[model samples]
Target: MADPVAITAPTTVLIKVIHCIVGIMTAPLPHPTGLAYHRMGHCTGRHRWWRPLLGTLLFLGAYLVLSLVLFALSYGVGAAAGLRELPDGGHDFGPLANTALDLTSIAIALPLILLAVWWPGRRPPGTLSSVDGRLRWRWLARCLLAAVLPVAVLAVTAALLPDSGSDSGEFGAWVGWRSFLTSLAVLAVLVPVQAAAEEYVFRGWLTQAVGAFVRSPWFAVLPQAPLFAAAHGWGTTWGFLGLLVFGVVAGWLTIRTGGLEAAVALHVLNNLLGFGVAAAVVDGLSSDETAADSPWQLALADVATTLLYAALVLWLARRHQPRRLASPVASSPAPAPAPATTGRTVGHHGESGQDR
Candidate 1:
């Protein structure tokens, strides 16, 4: 969904504050190690089989309630006011709308996830972000930068191919500068948040959920792949396979890097480009088509580009060696300050003496 996220000083400040919290949270763990990102829920060494199960339930119930409240507030109280949603008893969405609304719906999950972890899961909320118990913003930024190229490559490859999926031979008419720009504007804000939220839920929460029970990273990684694909709804066989591959690859990278940054980076860029392209053409955003709708050729292209992106990110990880485990190796204590030089010479008896 493409609900408009206002570009405001408050939002900017809020983001900065969040990054600041990461460092603060990561400051105290002593010898926090031998844990992968998937096992973060067990970071406190208090893993019950039912903790994540309960957190899941809490997240779902809260999500449903919050979604309703948000809809009511946005559509009922705001510009979409007075529009009746229910003919009989169902909720109305026509008043408030789609993409944006949908985006807003998913975006809220990111925060609620932390809450669920902190409360029901009985762990620090930051663990949901990484094994370090917080986001490593610098690492995330590097991944984000590394992510852009492959998505662009995918885009160019798609453009190079025939329009196998389009009904008409031509791409649709221009959406006009105003509409096009508006869509980009809104998408720019929403895509990153929505994509990151998915990573938190699937790669972060789901992986940790399973990892808490198992020792193998493969066990933690595989189950969420199908679920992630299923979340998009089955589109075509090839497309479904593509999404599955995407999920598996992304999950693996999340564990490999010890956080969700790589996954989130790729997802954010992929979605932003996809949405930007759709918004460029008439009725594009209105089209319900998603990554799940790709043809076999496009799906193949996606696989190639995605793999390439993963390789690139892994290479970057090697060079930078950002912590991919429970806690970064702590810095050694600063050497104690050198003793101040006394002007007097020390005696062989180890006493300070007057100049010899």
Candidate 2:
């Protein structure tokens, strides 16, 4: 039998990085018993009014750098493929190509967001996911399972709805199986990362940092919703409103559950199901088209579905004991007390004597 090799220092660091990544992916759903967002803010150390500003700047700076690198790489690929420029002087990577590239860029940028949280928040990276700074994998898995039904219902409802004249082409453009499968493969690998990245940035890092400054979870959660919606650039009032509602609900879940896991699960499942269905059924996956301007009935249906999902998650969370936030000191076991030592031991006759 070969002797076991010692773990090298580099190997240890790599393992930790992998662990943190996994934690980010598996943040649990919100539960009443979970730590409150306000309390979680306290875990990030002393609150500073300016910390959130700094954190935001750090995130944007890191993301910008990643975006530039991704764009350069994408341009090189288009150039290599001899892709021609559009009449507007922009290169047209086909729909599937564009979707895959966008997802890839998001996946690559996620780690930088984590880095921003770690650097400006001045806390260990895992705290961005939960109050305890560790992901509850089992809890996260449960939330993901809970998310499927609502997301599926929403996707199917959207599919069945009559398309408005606007962006009608988005629904009918079907790439061949080869392209579809390729896009599926990319989405399967990167969508979760992309979704989790958004949750970490808006629901996790921003919420906590802002919560710390304001000392109230509501202030932390509500204020970021518009910013979240703006980030989408949905290009329509209704689309913007929908995204704003989505962000607000996600923020509420984060506060109620005392962590980002529930919100992450909801976001991940929704994107995965939505994108997967689009790739399978739609003509072009890259273009954004939704029934945002549909009749009040359809919009109401969408809102109802979202509410149902949130209710189910909250109900399930009620059934289970909410996980208490683990204290940092408690997470680390105390060193075994050193054996009491004496310079000299009293002999049987009471004479001081050293033990051999």
Candidate 3:
């Protein structure tokens, strides 16, 4: 199979094109998610010229930074500990430590990253005017459903299963409060570094660029999902699926809410809770060499459960309004109507008319 990194860019572009085609095909119909925040005012309009380029730059920079940090930490620690005898893939690291680091980092970074995107003074910043007609309880319900449902189902199913063969990996006796807390502290530094970077690119940058340029929410949804998935690399099919679902949910939430705040909040929460839970589970268990067995069944169960969980969350959250504010068709200023007489000229600036 072609390496994911090699194909990620082309694949993401292709997905965007496919989504645009689908959106164009479906333009006449109502958007299915109970709201058309992206369609508010106009379904098609001129997009900012720099959107795609800016988004791509942000994605690349974020990825490089996070990758370097993780690599350095893992390599430096491994070398210092003289754990060359350690197993490949280093599954022996305490799950709690890994997870804690992940949660802390993401939780911290999400807010700051969003501020850069959503702050009032930023260029090309999304504004309240970009929001749908008005807030609706139904849409909120859908957001919650999409966010919570998959996780709940996965948790329940995982709880019910007997220790599967794949569950046997040892977290190593080296993990304790000090180690776990240290990892959490490191993650506290990196998770935000990672998570904020992701949301900024995928949700803030990519979603708007694709939606505006392609002229459809569905089209906007396409590019981000697979790119999000592919970034996980090959061994993590489960993680990839989780990211894809998350991308869809986050995209819809941002569109429906008419802003990125809700999606960012939900994403930060999900990452924090998910990693924390995984760490707790791993920390409580002892190291077992044979724990790593067939994970296919568990993977399937997790996927199914996650889908169910998302559905339930939607059922509980409120919906958003469907009406949209009318906006001008083009980016250029709208031409004024000719006056009845040349000397009876009237100048118009913005919404005001100078008829004095």
Q: What tens-digit string does per-residue lDDT give for candidate 2 at 1-356?
A: 54345547667789999998775544432223334554554453444567567877877887888888778877777788889765534356976677766777666656876776556655556767766566667778878888888877877777688754564555665667886788788888888998888888788777776767675668889877888877766566766677777788888877776577788888888777767777875655755554344444455555666688789779877987445353443233334433467445555333556533
Tens-place lDDT per residue, model 3, 32-54, is 23324443322333234564455
Model 1 misplaced stretches (Cα beyond 4 Å): 1-27, 30-32, 71-97, 166-171, 328-356
TM-score of 2: 0.77
Q: Per-residue CA lDDT of candidate 1, range 191-253, in tens? A: 899999899999988899998888899999999999999989888889999999999999999
| Candidate no. 3 TM-score | 0.53
Q: Worst lDDT window (10 residues) for model 2?
A: 329-338
Instruction: Kindly report which residue stretches of model 3 are placed more than 4 angstroms away from their true locations once superposed.
Output: 1-47, 62-150, 167-197, 236-239, 261-266, 281-296, 309-356
lDDT, candidate 2, at 217: 66
- Better model by lDDT: candidate 1 vs candidate 3: 1
State each candidate's clash count. Answer: 6, 8, 28
Query: What lDDT does the true structure give each of the candidates?
Result: 0.81, 0.69, 0.50
- RMSD in Å for model 1: 10.7
Query: Order the candidates by TM-score, highest first — what do you get?
Result: 1, 2, 3
Best TM-score among the predictions, by candidate number? 1
RMSD per model, one decimal: 10.7, 7.5, 13.9
Q: Indicate the residue-level lDDT of 269 in model 3.
A: 46
